[model samples]
Target chain A: MGGATFKGGVHPDYRKELTASLAITAMPAPAKVVIPLQQHIGAPCEALVQVGDTVKLGQKIGESKGFVSAPVHASVSGTVVAIGPYNHPLGRKVEAITIESDGQDTWHEDIKPHGSLESLSPEEIKAIIREAGLVGMGGATFPAHVKLAPPPEKPIDTVIINGAECEPYLTADHRLMLEKPNELVFGLKIMLKALGASVGIIGIENNKPDALRVMRQAVEGEANISVVALPTKYPQGAEKMLIYATTRRKVPSGGLPMDVGVVNHNVGTAVAMCEALHKGKPLVERVVTVTGEGVARPANLMVRIGTLVSEVLKACGGLKETTRKLIIGGPMMGLAQTSADIPVIKGTSGILALTEENVDLSEPSTCIKCAKCVGACPVNLVPTFIAQAAEHELIQRAEKLHAADCIECGCCSFICPSRIPLTQWIRLAKADILERRRQQQK
Target chain B: MQVLYAVAALGGIGILFGVLLALVARFFAVQSDPRVEAVREVLPGANCGACGYAGCTNFAEAVVGGEAKIDGCIPGGSETAKEIAALLGQEAIETVPLVATVFCIGDNRMAKDLFVYDGIQDCAVAMKYANGFKACTYGCLGLGNCVRACPFEAITIGPGGLPVVDKEKCNGCGLCAKACPRNIIQILPKGTAGHLVLCASHDRGKSVTLACEVGCMACKACVKACPQEAITMQDNLAVIDLEKCDDCGECVAACKPGTIHPRRNLPVAAPRPQDQVAV
Candidate 1:
């Protein structure tokens, strides 16, 4: 169809077949849940419930007091057991509220279905999204309302729906498309209306033919909406990449999609919006794909946030004897966990386990300057140079090489023949460069 | 006549350019604080952001603007701090020279292996698998996160699969300590004799001994043997107060497992033989 796409992207083995065909199942509540305060990108929300406080499911347990934070909600009806430092997925102790489940699974009685998206105004929708504690479900965990509210000068012209489930070994978005296509379409329309945009485009990877067909049919005859199938590749769902692939536009460095008259949201985020607007549901649960060679059975499950990885593993027929590594999200960008005690957050799309044979623990080799990382970079950045600068502690040099522009899609590390940890170094460089800039300002 | 004509033409062109430049400079001139530029000129220009600024220039501006103090740059050492203090017309503040130290004593022999790591060699990545292959959950993963984190090439993975810091090359930027997920790397005072505790694990005696052969058991033997009483047990970890230490090498001899040792004038600790190591 001669669809628009950006240059320099790679295609990795998408092992989504392990659980792609499975229907979404509701996971039984875990015995205990550990809800971290800092689940989103900005400041951690302050905990409202202390030790011994009894809370119901969907109750707001943590409240956002800052401009760039998201509130936390209780996923189970339980008593707060502790509120001090607890083990977090980011490898440090953070203030987390531990809840001992009462097994009642009772809602707070205020969550009633609002019936349709047409009833809510843009401001009302934004308020509901904020109150529901909704964040970007595309593994970014950015506050959803903040994305909706751009500065008055930056007028958004186009709203793009990112249906491109490009990461390998994850198909939560694919399942949503096949099952909840109408909800996704409704949510897209709501987002476009809220942004005051006249047009919307849904960019789906060509790999998910069924999802594309279903979504295309759902949006048929809608004047302001269209669906475009992009070439299958890793990180096609990244905001800049999606904007570039669909509209042939380049978002400037250190700029957002809205800077170029566009805004993009993941399909899962759209569905979450629909739920928040229509069903009056907070973001307590999300679809997580439980799959890999290490599981006895693989399936997609709607799991509550703060549920333990061990609980999800148990629901998916427990781990096989050979299960060696547990990773959160897809294999490409997922963080390998220290233990199964870590809780699922809004950004978690999948829980993957790899057997001893499937797991790659090979020692990293020296870079051969293959420039595969360059070819694979959707942003046209030179990852190897950034890694080199970071290794030499030349952070300013790394910034000059555009280390801050790295999206950390794990494309460079994934495609590198040398198995060099390019993304990790770039991440460190980005952090240092940002900190340096901040310190300069202060 | 031709020479006169050429000279007149040249003179006319020069006059025109001079007038235009004056007009442009007068119209587009930007008014900035002269003190900011003056302070920037006096800075060490390392732009290390140790002063909590984006760069040396930014730090200079902040200091001139009264937003920051004089003693900000750790990488610049005390001399740079004194220069900055002089530029600000403030009394010079005394500063300590800091250095990075690897707290883990877990080598191949001391620490047990979980599995053979063959993937991307990064402590952060290695730490994804139940705290890497090290039997001590708190020990260094030896994937060289600190090596990668060091901007000065001060830290490197030695032959024993543990990080070794070169004190001479270390700038004490504290980047390695922050980069560590296990938080084993520490920035301590680079003492006069460069002697300090070599172990960092806070685990109790038996568990520490079981996890790694060379781990600090917190037996307090060193604390008792110190004539200056510089060593104290805090949170089950023996911390040697550098201010009180006299560098007598008494703690080194008193340590039963040889966890505490002098950084200089000590025999090079050899790596355990490969065949004797367990997978």
Candidate 2:
């Protein structure tokens, strides 16, 4: 079937067959969990529980006064053993609450159903979503309630559920769609009702035909909701690209989706919202895809939010001795971790372990003027030029070239014939330009 | 006869163009202060921008325009300042020469690494990945961004994975200080007869001991042992006020971590001359 697609993307060796068909298995909770306060992109939460205090499952342990932040909950019923700096998946030590599990699976008393979706008001739904600590589970980890509560001037007319797990070696969204399509649709209905949106679309890549079929069947009777197949491409799951592919809308550069009267949420985020609205559950557990050439048993496992990556790897038979790289997300945009001691945060989508054969250890060479990166940039930027400007400390030149417009999809670096690390250079340029702008304002 | 005629025609055109260019040059010349040119000649042409101006030429114009002080040229130090003051018919302000000093002593043998980092060879880029894998977060990454940024080749990565500043070559332009990601390179008054705190790690006693052998543990021994009370503990690190410090080695002998050393013994300071005093 013909599918809607975007411009300028690459097709890497998608090794989804490694775990696409493997059903998501629920792993037992580890003995201890380290939950960081700043999982979402906002103000970090303040710990509400002290050491030696007992907390139940789904208990709000940390919260912040900032409107953009999300609260953290106890993933497992346990005693707070420690509260201090700990390793996070984002590569720095953040203040975290460490709990030693009591081995008893317990739920909080407040985790009761909030009645049917039709009975809840828009304001009430948003409050419930915020109280549940819902965030974009597609690795962006932007608070979901923030998107639902757009300003009065920018009204959202369409809500898009991103089901395109386009990153290589990731099948968590695919498995979630096939197994829990009803919950996904239910969450979308809640979002539409909250935002007063008319149209609801589920954009799934054509690579996962089974997921597309299941999601389509789930949305058959809904008049405003439909599942559309998207061309399997890298970063098609990005909010702007997905909006363009499915609804023919162009989100302006340096603009949010609300600027185009659209709101997008990840499919996993939808499932989490449904659970929060129906079962009064907080975001405590999520599905993490563990797969790579170095993994002994690659599978999709339902994991707790605070679970250490080392424990997850052990459950999956651990990384092989040949593993040279341990990444926290997909291969394209994932962060290469130096140690397995970091805890999984809300933004973690997968744990990828790469062997020597799967990694490229060659030094970056000079650009050959191939212009392939220019063609591969989805945002229409000349990666080569921006990278050169960044290397020479020419911030003004890089800013004039629109370095801040880069979405950091790693397409330019992937398409580079010289392996010039175009994306890293552009990232530096973006940071420098932003810093310069900040200083000028001061 | 034809050759002579061709030469005369070409020579006539050349003389006419030369006269026209001379007249244009005289008419279109822009007026500037003659002292600006003279001041630029006496200033160091490094254009290192430590004076907060664009270059030596801009600074020279600013000085002639009475907008910049004669002591603003840091690389030129007292010599250029005296010359510029003489040209401007003003008293030369006394100035002290400054040099860049690395605060970290956690070399490869003394410091521990948290992990093996094989990414870009830039300290800034490596800092983006878990603060460059150095167990002492305040320690230098030794990636040589400062070496590349130095205009006079005054900095080099020593054998210990630490930056070694050539005090003689470094004009204290502060370019290396700006290039360092950790802010470990400090510009201080040179030729002080006091001890220097060689460690920048502010971690507590336990962490400092675990990370680096030369890290300051903030045990307060140096503070108590200082005869003039020149050292003070600030955020688990020792701060030495060189102005109050005497030439005694009390703090150096009292330091348990051995992070403090004599400034004169580091191959850093030359014998202070009579004219080197800052007024």
lDDT of 2 by residue, B97-206 (tens): 78899888887667778776665579999889887878988888888889988989999888667888988999888999999889999998888588888888888989
Per-residue lDDT of B1-279 in model 1, one digit per residue for the tens? 999999999998999999999999999998877877777777778888778889988887788888887667677767876777777767533267788777777787777675565554668767765567676778888778888888789988888878888889997889999998889988877754635666677889998888877778899999899999889998777888877888898898888877776755432335779798643
Q: How much RMSD separates candidate 1 from the native structure?
A: 9.8
lDDT for each candidate structure: 0.83, 0.90
Cα lDDT tens digits for candidate 1, A1-442: 2267877777887888888899888988888998999888898989998899999999999987886888889999989998888766666778889999999988988787765667768787777778888888878888888888888899998999888988898989999999999899888888887788888899999998998899889999898899999989888888888898889889998998989999888888899888877777888999999988998889999998999888888888899998887888888888776578788888988889988897766667788999999998888889999998987789999999989988889889888898788888888889899999999999
DockQ of each: 0.17, 0.32
- Any residue pairs clashing in model 2, and if so which? none
lDDT (Cα) of model 2: 0.90
TM-score of 2: 0.82
TM-score leader: 2
Candidate 1 ranges with C-alpha deviation above 4 Å: B1-104, B112-159, B162-197, B201-211, B225-279
Candidate 2, superposed: residue stretches over 4 Å from native = B1-99, B186-197, B213-279
Clashes counted in candidate 1 amount to: 11
Residue B16 in model 1: shift from native, Å? 39
